[model samples]
Target: MNQSRVTDFILTGFPGLHQEYYGLVSFVLFLVYFVTVVANVTVFFLFATNRSLHKPMYYIILNVSACDLLFSTTTLPKIISRYWFQSGRISFNGCFVQMYFVHYLGSVNSFIFLLMALDRYCAICHPLRYTTIIKKCTIHILSVTAWIVGIGAPLALVIRAYPLPYCGSNVINHCFCDHIGITVLACTDRSPYSFTAFVGAMLTLLGPLAFIVFSYGSIFVEISKVADPKSCVKSLSTCSTQLIIISLYYVPRCFVYLASQVGITFSAGLRIVIIMLYSLVPPMINPLIYCLRAKDIRQCLIKQFYITTGRQKAQVFAVSN
Candidate 1:
């Protein structure tokens, strides 16, 4: 076995897509990245500026938006660079860092979604104790727990793969450095690490997903017990937007994992495209879904807009006087 370590890995990028499309793809991806950052930033600023929006639910939403922002910042710029400048080379250390963050932030997202579901469950299912249960201190603790577990879990996986030398090939078939993508390049037998990765992936994704499903399921049951139709609809409306975002995040990911495990083959290009769709689409739309659908955020944004416009009008009147 070759012991020479690979210094850098070249991303394979889209397999069959012609060079003529690179510009278009990069442009579109850039647009998505820009929108994702702006939307998340808007939410973060809104939460910071508006004390009225400082409830536990909105705080959790703010954390999710922040995670989405960091997730995109960590992964997208490199991908855009790959297409825009034809620069796909990433150092071994750099690749591992990217791989770590990609999975770490992903785990953080999953946990945050779980927390959001729990918050909703408390708010709706046990409305009487919701405030006492999910207090501000509890929110802070939960947020910290998500970050710690997110970083620690992925760090373990990355460390497990770290000692394996990558002497076989320096080309990663996917756009970004991911655990599976990097593990496949190992000089040693990949079964152990691959299995570890697969299991870890399932635990990280499905564990939180299971909790979310159960929480929502219970919430639904609780909603059914409500005698007033108007109250029931109002409760469902509060959760509907989150459910949509949760579905967007988990469903495609489950499909991809199931397809791969079942020996259903996808072309490299097709698989990467699908992966990108699932990964990028959620971050781009998460903030929008919440801001547009959630009543508090919408109200906050509307207030902000009017405040800004009113200030501008006052300045203009003062200058005229």
Candidate 2:
């Protein structure tokens, strides 16, 4: 067993996928990455530039879009490089940096979702006091707090992994440098790191999850109190998109985590594919969901496009005249 401080890591992105299919896989991943970037960036721009979207609800969405963009950019480019250019080697410092961002951005996203749920709960459950409860200052404070906690939580994990001896294998089984993937390569007793990671991962996933569930539960109770069926329907509709988005983000992650815990065996490639689905699918679909399902965003986009087209036609007519 070669034991020295490992300087670089070779990523086995898709271990089970045959070499003959790497080209096709890489091409498909490129398409997904392209769409993920474009879609998330479009929504982020809409949120930033549109004055009408300057509310707490949309503010949280803007945060989510930013997180998704960072998340995808952090994880996907390396994977794409691995498959497309056969460039899978990442330096030691680079690996930790990537791991930090990967976990940090993910934690930030979870907190944002928790904030979104609280926003909806306030909007529906305490309509009279919603504005008072979620003022601009409050939103700013909460947003800042979320970012701090998200980035801070992962810093500890990185510090723990940094001092460990990595004289074992330099090859990381997964595409990205997660706590689990990187720590496993350490030659020392990784139990403490593993335990710390488990606790952190649970807090990251389950803590927000518990809050979201409580919020929606309370939301449902409030919705049930409405006398008019149409009013009830209208109130519930506001939350449907959030519900769908939460399900998309959390369910597959929970499934993957639980499956691994219970020793439900999955092939290396299958596990990587599952993780990719949870990671890539949310960013790809989140913007689409908002654009398709949220009337205001969709209308704004359509109206913006129409105005641009009309201006182009007017320019053409002016030139001809």
Candidate 3:
């Protein structure tokens, strides 16, 4: 690991691994990718085509789906190509471009979750003003802000931290240009720079985490005052989902960052698996979670399906007549 090394990460990715393991990994990854894409696209369709789902929650859901799509797009193709074709070589600029999208959008994902907490808090605590407060413009502006801040903030930090050093080899353990992995390749001693990046990561992670915790805490207090039976249960369920999502995203992230900083050596496969979990696992399950808990989205999906079916039936009947 030389500090003055700069080429690009020559990834074996997944395809170039043990021949026997390639099939299994490819099948699983492809299946996960398929399911995530279908589910997210379905969510997007339901949100955009149907006028009924134009609510604040679904707006955030749309933003998340977009992020997940980008996240999956950033990682899966590389891994798939790596395994099936043994083509894992990426250029220096390509790696940075990939890193740019991954970091910027991953940051966006975190920020949107924070926005979701605030949306929930507003919907729950200030029911009368919910509609007026979380308007379309509000969601649009906030989402765009997430993208800008997420990408711009990390870029500034990287410019300052990475002094453009070049070392020896460019083998990346996993499929992607992992934040710390690339940082270690710089020729300079990365302690000062990495510490700054670590602090920045913690800051990015903490902002959303604190917002979620506080918003939910306040939501619970407000919930206790509500008398409606159905409303109380619904509020709790949504809040619970938020907590689960937060835990899923931040836990492995914390481990990856903390352990890397402390010099904990992780096996390559396990390390890749851990990083991929944030990108892979939660995305596959998010639609199901949202559908199961979200009465509004569920109804909208059902309604859309029925309408499509009904239109098909009407066309057939007319043709026969």
Candidate 4:
């Protein structure tokens, strides 16, 4: 076999940064993973352990946290492991699976969060009709639908990309086998792929933005009904939280995925801008959003801390005995 027929790719991290940053980068990444996992797990557990959080809003909140939890899990660890351990090499099959997880989980976060915004819109805007409209059955069906769209939309891409023979350098340029990375491997031409990528981007990115804008648009109209100045001001806080998180999540995504399609240069800065938007902002800021705007989650966190401390003291007493 000629050297040109080799079947693997190398990822050189940080085009501009020092190689020693691998260890430091990995350490920092691990710390972020730890915090993200802990924060979401606490949200999950808080929802699980408390009965008051069983409301539709909290259920949506817990699921949002769960989505972010899965979101971070899908990509961050592999990034850390790859940079530090030189264990970054992935088999073709492994790469496809990673791609699917990243794709689907990201889609799930978007749709699930769109539903959350809708949930808030209904609850605050139509308090009298909220319970009847968004019942448990509705919650279950909506959640299932979000997950299905997330997982299903990318099936065509996976089937198309995987079957084609990779007759050239298999090295994935990025840390992951992103759609474009894998698409580049197709020995065959990919003109028809444009439609599929466009649809997927619309479904996962643009579609959610449309829903968010529509929901918030209606929400503001309802909030405007509050003649009380203080309540109107208070109402803006919730909307602002959702808007901030949405911008942070969507701006870079639109830049890298959607805007790049429009011939914008996808330089390193664009990639870094996106990384902060999706990877950093959503996980770290979402918990803050819930804490600031959500009364129940804040209370749940408070109760969880006392309960955990009480259990710790009880364990100490038992050990002393």
Give one digit per residue, the lDDT tens place, for model 3 in 52-166.
8887778888888898887888878887777667677888877777766777777898999998898988888887998899888999999888887887667865575345575
Summarize candidate 4's per-residue lDDT along 1-321 as a digit string, tens digits. Answer: 533433555544444556777789888878888888887787777777888888776677677787788768777777788777967777777778777877787788788779878887887788799889988779878998988877777777787777766778776666566677777766778767757877786878878889888888888898888899898878777666667767777776766675666887767745754554466557866887777667877887887789889999999999999
Candidate 1 lDDT over 20-95, as tens digits, reads: 9999989998999999999889999989899999888888888888888988998899989999999989988999
Off by over 4 Å in 2: 319-321
Where is the poorest 10-residue window by lDDT in model 4? 2-11
- RMSD, model 4, all Cα superposed? 2.8
- Residue 272's C-alpha lDDT in candidate 4? 52
Candidate 2 at 39: error in angstroms?
A: 1.2
In order, the Cα lDDT scores of the candidates are 0.90, 0.89, 0.79, 0.75
Candidate 4: pairs in clash: 9-171
Q: Compared with the true structure, what per-residue lDDT tens digits does model 2 show for residues 1-321?
A: 655688889898988778888788889888888998999888977876788878788788888888888888899889888988889999999999999999999899999999999999999988899989998788879998999988777999999998889887999999899998999888878998899998998999999999999999999998898899999999988988888899999999999888888989898888888998998889888999998878778887898889899999999999999
The lDDT, on a scale of 0 to 1, for candidate 3 is 0.79
- Name the candidate, 1 or 4, with the larger lDDT value: 1
Model 2's lDDT to the true fold?
0.89
Best candidate according to lDDT: 1
TM-score of candidate 4 to 2 decimals: 0.88
